[model samples]
Target: MGEPLRGQAAVDQLLEVLDLKQIDAATFQGESPQVGAQRVFGGQVAGQALVAAGRTVDPARLVHSLHGYFVRAGDPTVPIDFHVESIRDGRSFSVRRCTAQQHGRAIFLMSASFQLTEEGLDHHGPAPEVPAPEDVPTMADWLERYPDRAAAFAASPQAVDVRYINSPGWVQPGDRDPAVHQRVWMRIDGRLPDDPLIHACALTYASDLSLLDSVLSIHGEVWGPGGVIGASLDHALWMHRPFRADEWFLYDQTSPSAGGGRGLAVGRMFTRDGRHIASAVQEGLLRRIGG
Candidate 1:
């Protein structure tokens, strides 16, 4: 079993592993795939761009929004250059635009904003009622239950732990009664930094995981062989409040539509206490091709 580290240390280690300056604008690289169909994981690029934006901001402010597009597939072997453009700086907010490049081509572009919190009235949607993380088995446990898929699951770089609250249709693909909503509990498997932005970025990275699949859930298509090709075309996030990534956060997701080989999924991140923390929207290319 891997020993868990503190959140701060985990974030620090991640920074060390993927230092922004080390990323060459002319010749950048990415981590190799342990599993998945794409050569590079979308979450990695999203997370790295967040980190790049985070590095340029004042720590006192927190990230409240981010939008990105994956214009092209990234080569896992090449380091990615992150060019951060300062969009604006104000007393209460700061904005940045970052473009992730590989092979002298733009692979991903992102815009992120940071804001200093202030006293304000609050209102939010109620938290969805579901099984707690403890009530549900860990993803690792599920993989262990299905030994055939354990190796593939173990090799995945999504070091964060996830436990589904409303389990989607796995045994019955394209058959589960279609519902617009889903929820999951997530947190890093190890420790991470105390910095709020780091936690936000980490969440940004984890947010992409399994979100698009919610659309497929409507069709009973689980991520596996013969499941078909699915890739995020664009992603957007809006942070409403501050929260610790080290703690369990509930991600409630809903898919509004799926058509023409595309699907749109929207989600909200809430603290265990029902405090809304962030919102996300994504559209992915979902197509059933040759197995």
Candidate 2:
């Protein structure tokens, strides 16, 4: 219904969206930013659902993983009601289920598990070599270079800075070369409150923005008219190590397969110094505009 906010304003709005209003022990209320989209952003719903679930668990227990399904398109104009269910609580782990509803219908579903911090053996693959985030083209550069996508780049919230290692799927044309992987550097542009749950929720929101890009990259397809259109069907994320979402992180993504009008993308998040932080997987319905 309105234009997107930028800079600190944007991140502030995002924070507001994530701060769900507690209606009762297991119920919370949330709303979408008036960005004029017919459907709410998938990331917003996912983040809000996580917020609701996090509120039900003990603060000492940190989220280790979450899985969510986008059951239906959420109407941004209406308020979203989230109901959290106490699924289970073991000595070291707690699980909760959350559902987002609008107009008496379910729009999203999620389950999250949290665990007490424990010392454990750990090892992960090193981060791939990539240009420093500062060296990558800024959004301003994209506006000047990719005139076709300037509108989108301009409208995007400046709260989250994104620098692509490859052309975005929206900018790719039929003649564009196919790629097996898509690498992007992104971070929340504003500082967030010192809460691990907030940071994790922020990362969960950011994760949804790009996973689908890798899916389209595999086929050299674009988005919108004359290209392929898509919607996220399900998303799952696992946090391996504690990291701040406000800092730059490398999102290395790849698509392994696509069939039956669906594509799966897997991504690994790594810190600048090569520390693997988290992993995300998503499958989306991709329909060719004109097949």
Candidate 3:
């Protein structure tokens, strides 16, 4: 949210960032966006760490889940070193732990599980009915209506095409009624390779973008200015079925609980045709500003 992240073309820059460099058999290096960001975006570190974990895994194995915690604020100017540890390899699943560090200090830690494809009993709830993505307004469209915030929006990175069912989290809470849930349709703005890992990693990067907004919905609060400032404590994601991150998917998100200076949000991703593909959970520390 500092400067436009150095590229009008975001996905390309993101692709380069996620493409970690191998330093050793178990270590990889990645760089944050070349901007004056106060801190590295958590998603970049997590996604890069996942890439490190995946590279050390069997090609036949695909990552199904990942849980990560923000250990420290990462330096945006420094390169991150990701160290992967093989926790176990069973007949069906391979587990890995990754630590992302900057200047010898661990900034993020993650554990991921990769599994061979297998048939399983499956059932899921129906996707909620909402206006199609085409019928919704994009950030660009909203910027036209809110001239005051247009400059800030223009200066921020736009890697994904997002259509919000509710107003964006940066909107003042008192400006509108509380949303039943914070819902948005999103996808990478550009085409990607057919690699499933890339798609997964892309989604992982995109996942952290707006998840905390669901938590803010509870108090009719947004982020910045009249709302609360928050930091992600941990994030967990589960890939349910195959899906492309470059295609439109509905992220139906809500906060089930909030207290003790923290709030939790859970979200489900549904494809255009309404198949549930993934679920994500995140908790963040929220502090009211100017209270």
Candidate 4:
């Protein structure tokens, strides 16, 4: 915290960039049958709400957990008004509740907790033995190598810096053996603020990129041309430590179940140094309508 007003100014700028007002609300709105039926990007709301909640707490207290529900399809064009409610301000822990509204209706809600860290006993699951991102080609490089599916891959804004840790199935989709786990490396294209909250908001944006796709990947379903209608129903995240969003972070995802037209996926995010920074869980409607 520099000058209190200066910090506030920076937070305001971050929110403005993440603001949902300029996006098309109609196209981004609702999950009903009449809509365009494309997957409503989950990271959009998650990142926005994280920024909203982060604005409420002290900079020393970093977010450790957030739980949110997608009540309805968000109108992408209408500015989503984020109403932040201060929940608590304990000495070591603080909490915030945020509601995202469009057209006078609540489309999303979230509750997040922040904590001022202190040294404590620690243990963590072993890091996955995957190939380092440096050795692997960048996503853009890979996409250029395969000209056919480049258009589809480039459609999502997230593809800007996101890359897979494994040889992906570019095309020729069919059912294959389900691999329970998957990994990817991601980071923002430009430098971001040093404030912990900004990094966390950026993390929220990156978290949902390929999460649900992990479920489809196991079934060998390529992500285009009628593979399935996938949407995230709810998202929860726990930030275990501090990290940078401009630097590559490994997102390890797994699907424990996919049945009854629904799928559940869990994710663990770790720094290149092997420190566990965050974990996430998401459940989605993954009905296969045919390709």
Q: Pick the candidate with the highest lDDT.
A: 2
Q: What is the lDDT of residue 262 in candidate 1?
A: 89
Best-to-worst order by TM-score is: 2, 3, 1, 4
Off by over 4 Å in 3: 1-8
Q: Write the per-residue lDDT of candidate 3 for residues 56-105, one digit (tens) a residue.
A: 98978888999999999999887899999999999989999999988888
Count of backbone clashes, every candidate in sequence: 18, 1, 0, 9
Query: Whole-model lDDT, candidate 1?
Result: 0.75
Of the candidates numbered 1 and 3, which has the greater lDDT value?
3
Q: TM-score: which is higher, 2 or 4?
A: 2
Residue-by-residue lDDT tens digits, candidate 4, 1-291: 111122234334434556433223212222211123243456767787777777667888889999999888876544567777887999999998888777788888889999998899888887787778877777667666666665554343331256677534343354244466778887765567687787888788778777887787787765545667667889999988778877878899988898888889999988888988899999988766662
Winner by lDDT between candidate 3 and candidate 2: 2
Ranking by lDDT: 2, 3, 1, 4
Candidate 3 TM-score versus the reference: 0.95
> Candidate 3 at 253: error in angstroms?
0.3
Residue 149 displacement (Å), model 3: 2.6
lDDT by candidate, in order shown: 0.75, 0.90, 0.89, 0.71
